[model samples]
Target: VRPGESTQDEPNQKWETEDWGIFSSKVRYAAEKQLDTAPLSQAITQLAISFVGTTYTPGTLEV
Candidate 1:
């Protein structure tokens, strides 16, 4: 699905079908792409804040 990819291939279709939940619901199925404008640090901070009070194993991806 880079630039000129075909969907007629069976393997490609199978992989897409296998992960249909995430792909179909969340993904924006279009041929165009754009740059993300939001800053990475800010995004990470916002996401980390959500887990600030949650008890996760001491230091493993817990905010």
Candidate 2:
């Protein structure tokens, strides 16, 4: 498979309901604050910082 691509038979990363909620909130906040107008790096940094303290599971992409 191509980079970051998974097949139907492979185990893939799954987002829980809470994860979706967090994503939705971030998208809404970004829209409301017009973060899209900011420089790409700045916007990416802002979004990355917002995930502080989030739980991360390593090896999720491993087959």
Candidate 3:
């Protein structure tokens, strides 16, 4: 896919507690640190880097 494209067919995937925690923390951190002022690519790269070493679980997106 393209740089900003999602491979998932569904756009409304459910978010688990862990996902929410991570997302909220990222959002809060971004707001506190003014990450929104960064270029989109830079922000995306930073976010992707944060996921480094994260374990991939099959069927985690099943709903």
Candidate 1 regions exceeding 4 Å error are 1-36, 58-63
- What's every prediction's RMSD, in angstroms? 10.8, 6.1, 8.1
The candidate 2 region of ten consecutive residues with least summed lDDT is 1-10
lDDT of model 1 at position 18: 32
Instruction: Sort the candidates on lDDT, descending order.
Output: 2, 3, 1
Reference-based lDDT, residue 15, model 3 = 52
Candidate 2: give the clashing pairs: none
lDDT of each: 0.43, 0.75, 0.71
**Deviation in Å, model 1, residue 58 alpha carbon:** 4.5
Once superposed on the true structure, which residue ranges of model 3 sit more than 4 Å away at CA? Answer: 1-13, 61-63
lDDT score for residue 21 of model 1: 48
Candidate 1 lDDT (Cα, 0 to 1): 0.43
lDDT of 3 by residue, 1-63 (tens): 333344476555545666667778889877876779989988888877777898879987456
Provide the global lDDT of candidate 3 against the true structure: 0.71
Estimate, for each residue in 1-63, the C-alpha lDDT of model 1 and write its tens digit: 432343565333333443454344323321122113447776555545544775656653332
Residue runs of model 2 more than 4 Å from their true location after superposition: 1-15, 61-63
